[model samples]
Target chain A: MRKLFSSRTVVTIIIAFIVIVGLITGSNWLSKRTNTPPFVQRFSNDLAGGVSRLISVPTTAIGRTANSIGNLLDTFEENQILKAKIDQFAQDKVRLQTVEEENRSLKKQLGLQATLTDFKTVSAVTISRSPTTWQSQLVINQGIKAGLKKGMPVLSGAGIIGRISEVNTTNSKVALISDTSEDANRFAITIKGNSGEINGIITGFNREKNQLIMGQVTSDNTIKAGDLVETSGLGGVIPSGLFVGKVARVTKDDYGLSKRIYIEPAADLGNITTVVVAVSEIGAK
Target chain B: MAFWQLTRIRVVYPVILFFLLFVDGAVMSGMGAFFTAFPWHVLPLATLIWLFYGVQFDVDKDMPFWIYVTATGILFDAYYTGIFGTYTVAFLIATMVMKQAKNILDERLLSGLTMFLFGILTFLVITYFAGYIIGIANVSIVTFLLFEVLPTVALNAFFAVIGYFPVWSFFNFLR
Candidate 1:
């Protein structure tokens, strides 16, 4: 038998180690210089994502069915609640229609053309969530073939969910705002106040509390609880005026130099399956 | 070369590795949605099963086992999107260590379990340190161990216990 400490085996091990370390550092450098991953890496991701989608469909369906069956147990209570809210919904619908018509007329008089916020959206089903806990990301069944590109905003039924991070030919990954990973998921958000707009950046997510922490608000801003927060469009890729969430509370930042706003995300990010990728106007960024 | 040898070692082995990669990338993650309410996360490294098989059955001390480990690690890094070469290096080191230890380690249930646990622990520690050094992992070491490391180890250990015999039999059958 060949000796365990043979020169050939030792040299192979050392060379392998050096090569892997080189690859690790080299790939990181390449990825940083180019915003997109290399094509080979992307192709591997696509292959895995495609196979995963096939396996996950039945699992997702089973989960949904189980949830539906559980919900059936509370159907009567839900029906009663819906019955009580129907009249209130009717009144709000009429009021909203009137306000929308007036707003459209005002916009016509102002002669303002449709803005970047006016986007064409394509729907995609989420194939998987990232298995790692450190990052909050979703793999969706849409990609460059579907006109998806990096930085395009994604939304669920309630509000904006995240932005597309990497796009392959047939699949894309979205980095959720809740992810604490460096600058990738940061959002420039505007909190609309009766007097003026309060601007802040969503810095991190308080996962324990299930709220978004928006910081860097100037102390002079007249921000308050229950104000609506939306994308400010300052970041360029994300469109202006996509609803993010409502401000749950206002607090002082760690340094007390500025205000921190806690936002309750409008979308039930925990239970999202279908999402819309908002394809914004070209050259808007 | 015999047809059965070519098919088993070249075709079936790589196919099994690819399937495991798919399960790790897609199926485990799809299942993660159901565990959103849980505080701790459980990431199952299905590839570890194959790695263990490589260590146990690689009687010739050939290059195929190492090649499979490297390819599996590369595919994992591609799908995971955390750090590019973390798994590649970790898997290589783990395989090397396990290969050296195989001389002393017996091929039995308890020994198999111990081997798997040792492999997984080394993989996790190495990957975690590499990720932290590269700025991919930002959590404190304590928090990482509590939330990610401990749970992952436990889950993968359970997989090792239950999956060991079946995987062993399959590799034997292939031989």
Candidate 2:
């Protein structure tokens, strides 16, 4: 015991502990920051991103091939189901086109250049998602050169999945909606109910239930299960009318003072191969 | 040390770790795609890092590995977690723990599994607390275990068993 507790050894232990604490504190500070990282950090991230992008070309190809094969088993039935929907969709398309044209002309007449729903999108391949469950981040191949700014909402073919958390020169990280990290940007969402649109904020996720927990709802609006939830665009960060998901349930907080709504996310947060980064046209000419 | 041996330590090990880290990400992408319901993830790199110390290197040869461990942890934090010191501190301490743990457990398959559990468990705990301190992690301990730790153990233990022999053979070949 005395040998183990030698003066030199004790000094070393204390120094190591201090170093560890400093590292944790320093890293935590860096982790929460959204600005451009140090040169060393950027260089390292770029190098890794380059490698992942090179590898993703093959991996994503293989993933899609495997996915198509899996979908083949259900294709016949899905074809039958889709054929029926296509006819209905064809009629809806013409009606939607007419309505859109009228709305566009009316907006032009009103001298409105951009609205909350105005945005442009850039497509990018997803190299990978962070292995850790807590992180819930996706590494995309486009970055600063691609005009991807921080806080840009990312969408899969299905719907909005997350927002850009970090941007490097050739790559960016999207913090997924499922991410429980405190630094993650919260999504301001609205649920279309029988009465009207009920607004709320996405706060956390219930991993066990596979549901997104929407909180800070002061409204007692009649929100039913299966109601379409979309970005309200109240915050002006995320575009309005972007499909988020349908309401899964409405429950009370533990204190019973506030309402907690659970959302079944539209995007398959589990499997994302490609995404589009939504660049808001808020100030764009 | 021979020139070749030094090269293996300085160059080969880091190169191999880089690929292994990439494999973790690649495996994770496929796993997320196919096994959507299975939230348990495999950290082969974490297991491999432990194998580098606990099973392969005697403590005397551990000096160089500290640098490797630190570099690897920093890259992991920068590349994936974005929380720089979380993996660095966790992996560094786990390697220190591995030195003691290696003494108690032989380098058999079962022992390798135990070490993997030790390495990953320590990583989760240290990182969880670090995340908590940094205000990132919000899940309860029970949720962490259920969602993160248990599934990682289940998958990575099998990975540890299968990977142990190859890594052991490689280390012995280096010897």
Residues forming the 10-long window of minimal summed lDDT in candidate 2 chain A = A27-36
Docking outcome class, model 2: acceptable
iRMS (Å) per candidate:
3.1, 2.6
* Per-residue alpha-carbon lDDT of candidate 2 for residues B46-124, written as tens digits (9 for 90 to 100): 4345444433445236346677777877887889877666777777777767666777889666675676567667776
lDDT of 1 by residue, B1-175 (tens): 7776665654676777777766664544445544554345567677776777767767235346667787877776777663477777788777777777777789777876777777877887887677555555655677667876787888777877787778778767766
- Candidate 2: C-alpha lDDT: 0.74
**A224-275 per-residue lDDT for model 2 (tens digits):** 8999989888767678888989999999988888889999989987678889
Lowest lDDT block of 10, candidate 1 chain A: A27-36
Q: Candidate 1 — which pairs collide?
A: none
lDDT of 1 by residue, A1-285 (tens): 857698998999899778767777776666545646778777878888888788777757765776678679999999999999999999999998998798778879999666655567889998877655455678899988898887788999789888887788888888777666553458788889878987768888776566888877784768778899998877567778889999899888889888888998898665667899887764233
Inter-residue clash pairs, candidate 2: none
Candidate 2: segments with Cα more than 4 A from true spot: A1-26, A30-33, A182-185, A283-285, B1-10, B35-63
Error of 1 at B166 (Å): 2.0
Best by lDDT: 2
What lDDT would each prediction earn against the true structure? 0.74, 0.74
